[model samples]
Structures are given as structure tokens and as C-alpha cells.
Target: MLSGRFRLLRREEPERANAAIGLDIEVFDAWTGQARAAGTLSGGEGFCAALALALGLSETVQAHAGARRIDTLLIDEGFGSLDEEALEMAMEVLAGLEAGNRLVGVISHVAELKARIPARLEVTPGLRGSTARFVIA
Candidate 1:
């Protein structure tokens, strides 16, 4: 769930903001004005942007429906594409959204991200099939 309006404005181009839906998000190439090739975002930029858009849409929906509040967001396994700086920025954005009962869960295998977000629920193979356990730092 999201609170208020989530707007993603390019630092330079404020007029070209695009709307995004829950897991369905769009990634635009500012230079070519076209969508990137499918599964071609090498540097986490696509994932980060898509996440931002989803957040925006969720917020919009909540406000339009007059919901009082909502909490939690889940992101799974995509941090490998980002560089250190971009990763840091993404982490900051997620961390900064602590207000309004927002809880962001990033599911990632990257060691850096695992170390950064110390609390997590890990799932692993067990005697039968798999087991899940929460790890908190």
C-alpha cells in the first residue's frame, strides 16, 4: 500500500512523467524516447525506475479511493543490475519511505543488499522441499 501521490520526475524533464501500475511498469530511454529492449536493463536503472512508478500508482489509487492508510511493499530479486551508486540511491529511497506505516521488503540475493538490509525472511531447501525463516539484525 502507498500513501499520497507518487510522482517520478526526471531531474531534467519534468514534463514527460509516465504513469505505472503495480508490477507492470514502463522504462523509457530519455535519449531515444523509446522503450528499452526486453530484459536488457543491465544497470538496475530499469528496475529502480519501475519500482518508483509502481509506488506512484499505488499512492494514486489509495488517494482516489479515499483509503485511510496502507502498508508494505514487496520487491523481489533484481538488484544485481545496479551499480554501487545507483544501488545506494535505491536503498535510500526505500529506507526514506518509513513514514505512513510504509514497510518495504526487498528480496535479493546480492550480498551487498543482504548486508545493507539486515532484516529479512530467508527461504531455503529443507528435508522435504523448503523452509522459511526470518532473519533480523
Candidate 2:
């Protein structure tokens, strides 16, 4: 879903990347279509690429390994970095993964994201402490 440019390559040399932080990957600009280092991506773009990778790997596991079923995916805090279009795409991907009794949980402080989510647990921070509430919309 990432403009068809999401690629996870297994390169062992540090010369290929700045840091071998694990999960070697590269992505192309959505508009420019030019290949670029995944590390060089803007915060939002990097988040998108990482999410796509996670989902892709999950699908691979589900496909090749019949003994396991990935039924839960939880994402925390990257929503605010995404632009409207990217956010929409990310949300759509997350929603699609919810098929087959899977539970997708997103934890974000973005108001736009909160508004779009129907069923959510709202956590409020007050002077004294914090309070949490759940909505089953």
C-alpha cells in the first residue's frame, strides 16, 4: 500500500547503511518515485514504511507458517506525524488487518485520529492523576 516502493533488503554491510539498527529497508518517494534510504525519510514517511514492513512480515508469517496466526497489532504514537493522505492510508491498512477476528489497537494523541476511531478507550490526565474511560461505539 506504500506506493509499491516498500522494500526490505537483507544487507549485512554497514557500508550500505548508516547503522545496522536491524530490519534493513529502503523506500521510494511517493511523489518523486526516487529511491532513498529509509533512514532519510521524514518522520511521517519513516513511520509509514515501518508500519508497512510490520504488516508485511505478519502476513508472511501467517502465510508460510500454518502453526501461527497473528491476531493482534498495536501501534503507539506515530499518527501525528502523518499528513492527511498518509494518515488515511495508514488507517485503511490498519482497518483491513482487523479482518479474521484480529484486534488492532492504536494509541495516539492526535485529535483527528481519535475522532475517526469509533471504539476507543479515552485516558484523561488531570491535576491529581489520570482517569480512563472506554467507549464501545
What C-alpha lDDT values do all the predictions have?
0.66, 0.79
RMSD of 1: 7.6
TM-score of each: 0.66, 0.82
Q: How well is each residue in 45-124 modelled by candidate 2, as lDDT tens digits?
A: 78987898788789899899985989999999998899988899998888877755789999999988777789999999
For residues 1-137, what per-residue lDDT tens digits would candidate 1 score against the true structure? 11212223343433336844333323455555665432455546566667776777788888988784558888887788877777877787788776556988888778887677768888888789989989888
Model 1 is weakest, by summed lDDT over 10 consecutive residues, at: 1-10
Candidate 2 regions with alpha-carbon error over 4 angstroms: 16-21, 28-34, 64-66
Q: By summed lDDT, which 10 consecutive residues of candidate 2 come out lowest? A: 7-16
Residue pairs with colliding backbones in model 1 are 44-81
Separately for all candidates shown, the number of backbone clashes (residues 3 or more apart, or on different chains) is: 1, 0
Clashes of 1: 1
